[model samples]
Target: VLRGQRPDARVIEAVRGVTFDVAVGESVGVIGPNGSGKTSLLQATTGLLPLAGGQVLVRSIPAFLGVQA
Candidate 1:
């Protein structure tokens, strides 16, 4: 999720600016090749990363596949 790093890096624009939403009873899947910004997107949505140009919001618990939840 930490893209390019800099001593004073304050802006963090996620690759491609991918964003989406799901309803109370809706389901969605995120499919992409390796290193396709999937993890980054999850992290950003989970408030683990900061948005550079936009915003991300999550209203439920997130269960990460590999990393600690």
Candidate 2:
């Protein structure tokens, strides 16, 4: 290892300040402009990504089939 060196610690902000709910048997949708983090919000709710903060409540396990960029 190199002496007196620091590692890179970078972070990105995807989604923020989002809140909503759906009633039983109700339908819902998420819409936004491209690169607006529609997918990132979904990922956090489904557990595909670790949430830096906040919480997700669900009646059942989520299904994920995410594609790589």
Candidate 3:
């Protein structure tokens, strides 16, 4: 590979076909085995990761999805 040349990228579908809703004051949890994209789902929802397809609706003006040190 040439210097400074970007390598070919592979696309892996971490999360797909997932849909859910939390009512006002409702709560939920995501549980899955390792490599099952649990973190991917949350990241996508929180704007950390971009979604190939799908959308997230946040009622709060600013959603605190993660804590920054």
Clashes of each: 0, 0, 0
TM-score of each: 0.57, 0.65, 0.67
lDDT of 2 at 20: 80
> Candidate 1 — which pairs collide?
none
lDDT of 3 by residue, 1-69 (tens): 011223565456887788677897988889999989987787767766655566666664435355421
Model 2 shows how many backbone clashes?
Answer: 0
The sequence of per-residue lDDT tens digits that candidate 2 reaches over residues 7-47 is 55444577878878778899988898998888778777666
Q: Using TM-score as the measure, what is the rank order of every candidate, best first? A: 3, 2, 1
Candidate 2 lDDT for residue 25 = 90
| Model 2 alpha-carbon drift over 4 Å, by segment | 1-9, 59-69
* Error in Å for residue 18 of model 2: 0.8
Best-to-worst lDDT order: 3, 2, 1
How close is each model in CA RMSD to the real structure? 5.6, 8.3, 6.8
What's the residue-level lDDT of 5 in candidate 1? 59
| Model 1 regions more than 4 Å off | 1-14, 57-69
